[model samples]
Target chain A: MADVNVSTLSHSPKDPAKGAGKLDDSQGNGGIPAVELIELLFFAYRDFVGDADELLARLGFGRAHHRVVHFVNRHPGMRVADLLAVLKITKQSLGRVLRELVDNGYIDQKAGATDRRERLLYVAPKGEELARQLVTLQTRRFARALNECGPGAREQRESSSLP
Target chain B: MADVNVSTLSHSPKDPAKGAGKLDDSQGNGGIPAVELIELLFFAYRDFVGDADELLARLGFGRAHHRVVHFVNRHPGMRVADLLAVLKITKQSLGRVLRELVDNGYIDQKAGATDRRERLLYVAPKGEELARQLVTLQTRRFARALNECGPGAREQRESSSLP
Candidate 1:
C-alpha cells in the first residue's frame, strides 16, 4: 500500500494532552487529537506491516508484492484486468512486481475462464501461506489497538480513528 | 507514506471480538477479523484524507499542498529543516508544495530566531482560517464518529482509535 503520500508531522504546543500517542498526531490541527492522527498512522502502519515485511522479504518480495498477492488470494481466479481496477496501477508499473512474484513461484497465472486472452491469478500454497501470514500478522496490531482503546469506544474507535 | 519499508511489515492479526470490525467477506485463510483489518485500513485512510481533501480543496489546494500548509499550521514557527524531517521527504520533493503555500500567502516565513539561515514558518491569518476550517471540520467528523461508537469502547477507542 506504499504509494506517495506525505505523512507524519511534529505536533507543537497546540497539543497539551498527548496521551493518545503517535496515531492521534496526524489528525489534529491545533488540538491534541487532530495531531495524534499522524502518530497513529505512523505507529499503526509501522506496527501492522512489521512482521509481514519480514515474511515477504524471505520470499524476495516487498509489501507492494504482498498487496498484489493478498488481493489475488482474496479473489481467487480473478483476472489481471480486475486486479488493475482494484490496484489502480499501470501495467508497466505492475509488470515488474508481478514478474518478481510469479518468478518466485508464489502466483499461478492461468488463462482466464471466459476470455482466454486475459490472465487469471491465484496464489500457490506458498503464496497463500505468505499472504495469509502477512495479513494475519498485520491484523494483530489493529486488534490490539482496538482492544486497548477499550470497550466503550468500540464503535467510535472504528469509525473515527480511521477517517 | 507510500514507500512501505521491508522491516516495517511485521504486523500480526488482532482479535476481532477485541473490538475491531469483524470481516464480512470469506474467512479466506486469514479469517474475517484479519480481512476486516485490511478494510478498516482502507476505510480509515480514505475517510481521514477524504475529509481533509474536501475541506482543503475549498481553499484551492489538493492533499499534497494542503499537507504542507496543515503541518505548518499545526506547528507555528516551525523550522524548514524540522518540517523536512517530520515529512520524511527531500527538500526538493517538498519544495514545490511549500513554495505554493508560501507564494499563495497562506504561510509566513521569517528568519529563524536561533539561526539566521533557517526559515521559521507560521500560518498567516488567511492560512489559519483555512487551517481552522479544515481542522475544525475534521474534528467534528471525528467527534461525531466517536459519539456514535458510544462510550462503551472508550478505552479501546482512546487507545486504538484516537492514536
Candidate 2:
C-alpha cells in the first residue's frame, strides 16, 4: 500500500534474515521491521476469509455458521458448553446458528456419553465437507502468502523486534 | 476456541512470514499445526478492535468508523473512489458514514490536487490518534497470539480445512 523498498521487500542477498519484518516500517532506525508481516497478516486475512465468505454465501450459509462448523470439526467430541465458552455468544444466538448447522446436515450433535445433558459435537460428512471447503479456502490463501512473502520473514525479524 | 490453541497470545510474537495477494489455487492448506492461529486471530481480533469501540460508544462512533479509520490510516492520501472500491459499500451508506467520521474530526478531506473532482483523504491528528490507539490495541493482541501459539504451530495445516 505504500512505496516499496527493494531492500525491505524482495529477497535480500545480505542475510537470509534481513527483510524479516522491516519493509513496512519505512522511516528507518528502530521501527519494527516486522511490520511487514503485520500488514501481510491483515491484508492476507481480509482476502483469505473473504474467499470463504463468498462460497458460504452461495449455499445460503453465513459467517456464523462457518465458525460453528470450524469449531466442531477442530474438536470432534467437544460439548455445547465448550462451544459456548469458545464462541462467547449467547445461547439464544448460538442455538439459532447451531440449529441451522445441525439441521442442514453440516454438523452432528450426539448425546453426551457420560452426562446425557451435554451434547457432544462432530462434523458429519456434510458438515465436514463444507468445513473442509472453507478451511481449505483459507489455507490456500495463507500458504500463498507464506510462499510469496518468504518462509522466514517473521523469524528474521524476531531477533530484532519486540512482539 | 476449541482444542485449537491460542498459546502465542498476549505478547505478539515476532511474526515470521505473512503473505498477501489473490494467487490462490483453491486447494491450498492453512497449515494444520498452526490451525490455532486462526482461532487466535478470531479471538485476538475481536478483542483487539474492542477498546476503540468502547471509546467510540461514548461518542456514538461504531464499527463503521473503525473500518473507515482503518482503511484511511492504512492508505493515507487515498481518494474517495479508491476507498469506495476497497469498502464495497453503497454510496449512500458510505456517504453517511464518511460524513460522520469527518464531522467527528476523525478524518480530513481535500480536493484532489490533479483531479479537482476527486476528493482525497487523510487522517487528521485526532483521527490518527484514535486509529493508532485502536489498531495498536489489536496489534498487541496479535503479538500475544503469535507468542502463545508458537512460531511453528500454524505453519502447515492451513488449507483444505478452513473453515
Candidate 3:
C-alpha cells in the first residue's frame, strides 16, 4: 500500500496559475491565491484537531473513536447504516471502533423500535459528557480563529471567489 | 490500547453550560455552544482533507508525506532540522517519509550554503505541481465555506467572544 505508483493515478491538467517552481512572493500572484493562506488552513486544522487528539490519546481512543462518539452524541438514535455511510468506512472497520465505544460504555446500541435488525446508536451519560468536553475544546479553537480573522477576513472571500 | 480506562483520565469539572445529557433542541441552548457547529467542523475538515487524501492515496503517500511536501514547497530552502521541529516527529520516523519523497524526485535536498553539514529542503518541480494541486483543492473549500458563512458569520465571533 505504501508503494503505490502515483503516476498511474489520474492527474489534473497543469494549472497555468501555478507557475512551476516559482516562489509565491505576493498575496495573489497574478490572481493565484497566496500559499500562506493554504499553509494557515493546514496549521489551523492541525491544532484544531490536536485538542481532541490529546484527550483521546490519554483515554486510549483514536480519531476513529472520537468520530464515532461525536456523531452518536450529536445525532441521538442514529442508525448504524447511516453512521457507516457518513463515515464512509466498511462495516468491518466500523465494527472494531463501534465495539470499543460500546464496550467502554461511551455508546449504547439498541435494536430499532420498528425494525429489530436495525441498530440505533445513542451516547450514554458518560459518553455525552466526554463528547461535550471534546467539542468544547474544538469550538473554543474555532471561536478564537474566527475572532482573530476579524471583520477584514471577509475580504478573503471576495478575492478568492472562483473566477 | 482500546481498552484503556476513561474514568482514570483527569476530567475537568463538569461545565454547567453543558447540561447533563440534555438533548440539544435549540441553537446555543441556554448559552452552551451548539454541537452542530462542532460536527460541521468535523465534516468540513473530513472533506477538506479528503481532497488531498485522494491524490495522496494514488501516490502511495500519506498525510505525513503531504505535510512534508507542502511545507517544503511553501517555504523553499527550509532546513531539515526546522522541518523536524515543525513536524514534531522523531528523526527516524521522518527519515522513511523524506527518503521516499527525495528518491521519487518530489523533493531535492542540498547541503546548506552557509553550513555544509546541514541539509536544506526544496520541493522539486514534480512536488511543486502536486503541492499546488492539493492546496488549490483545499483553498477552494475554505473559500466556499467562508463565503457561505458571510457577514453574519462574524456574529458568531461576537457571541462567543472570549472574556
Candidate 4:
C-alpha cells in the first residue's frame, strides 16, 4: 500500500468543521483531513483482510472466492442476482468465481423453489467449515483490537461508525 | 461480499475472555466474535475504497494505479525495490503497472543517486495532482466518519488501534 501522507501526525481537533478554536493550530489547515487516521485505516484493513487472504491462497483461491463463500454461507439460498448486488460486481466476474467454487464443491447452486429460472446459492458443508475458519481468524484480530481498546469501545464504535 | 455470519448481532461484553461473567450469555459462546463488528469493517472498507475506485475507473485506471501514484507522490524518489516491499506484489506485476504509469507520463523513472543500476521512481506533476484528488475523495469520507463519531474519537481510536 502507498503512504498517502508523509508527515508526523499530531492530535488534531475532533471536528475540522469546528476549526482549531482555542488550541494550537499546528495542523495549519482546518480543512485538511487527519492523515494518521487515514493511514491507520489503510493498514488495519490490510492486515484484517490479509489473514483470510493467506488461507485463501493456500486453497488456490483468491479473495473473490472467500467473498462468494462467505455471503452464500450467510444468506444460504440467496439469489445469485442478490449476491451480485451485494458484491457490486458484474455477472461475468461472478460467473467465473461461482463456477470455480461450485466445481470445487465449496458452494452449491440450485434453482429457486418457486421460480426455476432464478439461481440460488448455498455454501456446501465444506464451504461452511471454511467460512468458520475465516471468521475465527478475522474475529481473533477483531477481539484482540477491541480488548486492547478497553470495555465498551466496540459497541460505541459500531454504533457510531457503521452504516 | 458474502455475509460471513448470518445472525442478528448484539452488543457482547467488551472482553469475552472473562467468559460473560455476570452477564447474559445470549451470544451462547463467549468465544464467538461480534459479527456486527466484522460486518462493520467489511462495509466500511468497501465504501471507503469504493470512493477512489469510482474516480479511477473514469480515468481508465484501477486500484493498482491509484496505489502506484500515491506512493510515488509520497516518497518522490523511492527505489523500485522499496515499493515492491511496501506493496508486497511480484516484480512482474509491478513492472506492468510501472510501465503503464511511465508511459502515461504520470511517473518518471530515473537512475538512483549512487546506485546507477537501481530504478528509482518519482511522480510527475500530473501524478501528484491525481494523488491529491484521490486523497481528497478518500479523506472526505474519512473526516465525515470521524466527525460523526464525536469529539476525541479519532485520537482515541488511532492511538489505541494503530499498528
Candidate 5:
C-alpha cells in the first residue's frame, strides 16, 4: 500500500498554479473538477486500509482473507450463495480463501440441515478472536476520523445552508 | 473487483440486531465499535476505485498502473525517486509497472538536465488523455458524494454543535 503525504503532494501555498516538481503546470481545460479532492480521496482510502493490510500481511494473509473473516464473523451461518453475492467474487477465489480459513481453524463450515447441499459458514473461536482484533484496530481509526470530522457536522451544515 | 451491496448486508431495519443473511445475530461483546461503520468504509473504498479499476482492466492495467499514471501526470518532470517516496512501493514492483507504461506509450522518461543520471517521469500524450478521463470519472463520483453528504454540512454541524 502506498502511504501518501497529501500536503507534500499538494500545490504549494505561495504558488498554487506552479507546483514544485511539475513541468507542465497546465491543469487541463476549464470545468475540470478539482484534482486536490480526487487525490485526497485516493490517499485517504490507502491510509484507512493500511492498518488492516499490515496486520494481514504479518499473518500471511491479504485483503481477500480479511474480507472473508470480517464478513463471516459479521454474518455467521451466511450461505455460500449469499457470500458470493455480497463479495461479488468468483467461487474459485472464495473457495481458496475459505479453505485457508477452515484449514487454519479460523472458520467452520457446516451443511444446512434442511438443505443438505447448502454450505453455511461460521467463525470459529480463533476467527472470532482475530475478527475482534481487526475490528478494534479499524474501530479506533473510525472513531478518530469521526472525531476529526466532528459528528453530525455534515447534517448541521446541510440544515444551516438551507435557503 | 468485488462490488458490495452495503444496504443489503446491513442489519435489518425492522430488527436492528437481526439481519436476513446472518445466522448469528450476536454482535460481539461490549466496547466493540460499530460493525456497520467498518463495513461501510470497506465498501465505500471498494466502490470508489471501482470505476477506474474497471477502465484499467479494459486496458490490461491495474491499480498500480492507475496510481503511476495519475501521480506522474500530476507532477511531470518528477524524479523517479520522488515517485518512489510518494508511492512507497518496492523498486521491483514500480519498475515493472513503469516498464509497461513506457512500452505502451503511456509514459516518457527523460534524464535530468542538470543531473543527467537522474530519471524524470512525464505522462505521454496518450497517458495525459487517460489521466484526464480517469480524473473525470473520479471527479463525478466525488462530486456526487459531496452532494449526497450535503456540501459543507459537516463543517456547519461542527460549528453549530460547538458551545
Candidate 6:
C-alpha cells in the first residue's frame, strides 16, 4: 500500500457544484470546503465510535458484528435482505457475521410466516443487553455534545426525532 | 471474523453508572438508550465516510491513508510524535501510512527546526486538493443534516467551536 501513488490513479471528474466557484473567502480562496468543520467531525466521530470499539474488541467482535447486532436488535423481524441493503455489504460478508451472531445466540433467525424462504432476524436477550450498553455509551456522548451546543439544542433534539 | 461468537466470550462487569437507575421512564422500562438516535448515527457515519472510502480505494489506499493525509493537510508542520498521539495508532502503523503519503508526494516531512531529530509533516499541493475534495463531500452531508436539525441548530453550531 505504501508504494501506491494516489496521483497516478484515475479520478472521477470533479462535481461541478463542488468546484472552486463554491469556495468562500474565509477558506483562503483555495476551493477547500470548511476544513475546520471537517476535522472537527473527524475527531468527533472517532471518539463517538471509539466507545463501542473498545467493548467490541473485548468481545472479540469488530464493527461488523456491532452493526449486525445493533440493527437486528433495533428492528426486530427485519428481513435478511433488508439488513444487507441497509448495511451496504455483500451478502457473503453479511452471512458470515450473521452466522456468528445466530450461532452464539446473540441473534435469532426465523423463517418468515408469509414467505418461508425469507429469514426474519431478531436480537436475542443477550444481544439486546449488549446493544443497549453500546447505545447508552453513545447517547451519553451525544447528550453531552448537544448540551454543550447550548440551551435549546437538547429541547430541539427531544422534540424532533431522527427519520 | 464471522465465525467469532460474541456470546461465548467472557463478559466484563457492567458499569454501575449505566444501571437501571439511569433509565428515563420515557425511554421505556427496557433500559435501552435512544435506539433511533444510535441507528441514525451509524447510518450517517457510514455514508459520511463512504464517500472518502471510495476515493481512497481507487488509489489503493484505505482509511489509514485518508486519516494521515487529512491531519497533515489540516495541521501543517505537525510533529510525528504528536500525530502518533492524535491518531492513537502504533508507531509502525503510522509509519506505514505516513511513508506512503510522503512517497506519493502528498506529504512533506522535514526535521524539526528546534530538535533536528523530530520529523514535522506538511501536506503537498496535491494532498491539499485531495483533502479539500474529501472535505467537500462530507461538508455537504453535514450541511444537509444541520439544516434538517431545525432552525436554531445552525446558529448554535456557529457560536460553538469544537476544540
Which candidate has the top score in DockQ? 5
For each candidate, what is the lDDT?
0.60, 0.61, 0.65, 0.64, 0.67, 0.64
- The lDDT of model 3 is 0.65
Instruction: Please compute and give the TM-score of the first chain of candidate 1 against the native first chain.
Output: 0.68
lDDT tens readout by residue for model 2, B12-120: 2232222212333332434333355466566654555565567778878887777787667656666777666555567787898899988978889888766688677
What would the per-residue lDDT of candidate 6 be over residues B13-43, giving only the tens digit for each residue? Answer: 2222223224353433334345544555565
lDDT by residue (tens digit), candidate 1, A1-163 = 3211223223233523312222233333334465455436544664566667787777677877977887676667666665665555688888999888888898998885566897778778888777667766666555555554554643444334210
- Cα misplacement distance, residue A144 of candidate 1 (Å): 4.9
For model 1, what is the error of residue B17's alpha carbon versus the real structure, in angstroms, after optimal superposition?
16
TM-score of 3: 0.69
User: Docking quality tier of candidate 2?
Assistant: incorrect
Top TM-score model? 5
Candidate 2 chain A has its poorest 10 consecutive residues by lDDT at A2-11
User: Chain A only: TM-score of every candidate?
Assistant: 0.68, 0.68, 0.71, 0.71, 0.70, 0.69
Off by over 4 Å in 3: A1-34, A150-163, B1-34, B140-163
- Prediction 4 TM-score vs. true: 0.65
What tens-digit string does per-residue lDDT give for candidate 2 at A38-135? 44445545666678889999989888888888877766777777677667678998999889888888888778766788778877988877876776
For each of the candidates, the C-alpha root-mean-square deviation to the true structure, in angstroms, is 11.0, 10.3, 12.2, 10.8, 10.8, 12.9
lDDT of 1 by residue, B87-128 (tens): 556999888888888898988988865568878888888887
TM-score of 2: 0.69
Model 6 stretches with alpha carbons more than 4 Å out: A1-33, A147-163, B1-33, B144-163
Which is the better candidate, 1 or 2, if ranked by TM-score? Answer: 2
DockQ of each: 0.11, 0.11, 0.09, 0.11, 0.12, 0.11
Candidate 4 lDDT over A49-140, as tens digits, reads: 88888899999999889888876776677778777766778999999999999999999878877789977777798998888888777776
List, residue by residue over A58-155, the lDDT tens digit for candidate 6. Answer: 98888899999876665677778767767778999998988988888899988888779978887798998988888777777655554444545434
Better of 3 and 4 by TM-score: 3
Judge candidate 6 against the unseen true structure and give its global Cα lDDT, from 0 to 1: 0.64
Q: Which CAPRI level is candidate 5?
A: incorrect
In the range A71-148, model 5's lDDT, one tens digit per residue, is 887777777777777776799989998899899999998887777897778889988888887777776665554443
